[model samples]
Target: MTVSFTETEAFKTFFYAGEIRLLYFLMILMAIDIFTGLAKALKNNKLWSRKSLFGYARKLLIFCIIVLANIIDQILGTHGGILFVTIFFYIANEGLSIIENCAEMGVLVPQEIADKLAVIKNEKGTSVTTEIKEEFTSSHSRDLEGDTAEVKIKIEKD
Candidate 1:
């Protein structure tokens, strides 16, 4: 029998009251964050495709997390409480990031934001990968335990 998606329980659950709205709101926040981030990057002349790629990857991960939350809610019969909380958490995080980006664009920024921007300017991007790469390459490669990444990259042909 050919089945239509709208005839399925999954479709009903997917369109459950308020859940789709929350999802749309989260999407809107994510888009706004990207827009503000791009504006900030342009203002600072710091545009990079790598950063944009990572940003989209992070947004995808956010959606995955929310979907996981919804799955949990279904399993536990909490009626989407966990999913709503997950969505709201991302909303707040995205909102704060938008504020920070606006601050970089020279909006009415707070002193704390100004101080943070100053620090960011002096320091390179603060991704953990960047930090670890710097740690292994810098003169200060040795950690407190005198440890450093010692392996070199090589490919062995099969």
Candidate 2:
């Protein structure tokens, strides 16, 4: 099915454009969350069916909510804001759950990544500045305030 984009001024600005679709933004956000979770899982060597299923379900729910929001907008007018709010809520929830899942699997999910995720959740659709990106990448191996966890990977001998 084909859908057409309409220009509507809401919140003092145009909400939708001809090129940028809401679905596209949602997909990118969901993909980032899923990949981040998967990376943490792999780092801990605990990637399994359960975690993958959870991530998939979470992504599906986010997309479903977006569709629901569009339906609501059609039914009751002025519901785009509600869609943004729902997206933000799920984003934060899924982000936190990913961290928790990593912790369960013995992955530290470093405070640095957690902090970066928090900032992203708070900003909600804003780009991360260059300095922030550098700090995030550099935070991986450096000790923060000299507090670091020693991750011990065990190899079972055959």
Best by lDDT: 1
Stretches of candidate 2 above 4 Å error?
1-22, 91-158
lDDT measured at residue 140 in model 2 versus the true structure, 0 to 100: 50
Task: Summarize candidate 1's per-residue lDDT along 82-112 as a digit string, tens digits.
Answer: 8778888999878777876787587898888
On TM-score, the candidate that comes out on top is: 1
- In order, what is each prediction's RMSD in angstroms? 10.7, 17.5
Error of 1 at 142 (Å): 13
lDDT of each: 0.72, 0.57
Q: Among all windows of ten consecutive residues in candidate 1, which has the lowest summed lDDT?
A: 121-130
On a 0 to 100 scale, what is the lDDT of residue 129 in model 1?
Answer: 31
* Model 2 agreement with the true structure over 1-158: per-residue lDDT tens digits: 65434434341133332123444655666676677767866887878775478558756766666667655654566646666666667656655655654554566678887666557543444224323433544355374667868899999999
TM-score per candidate, in order? 0.64, 0.45
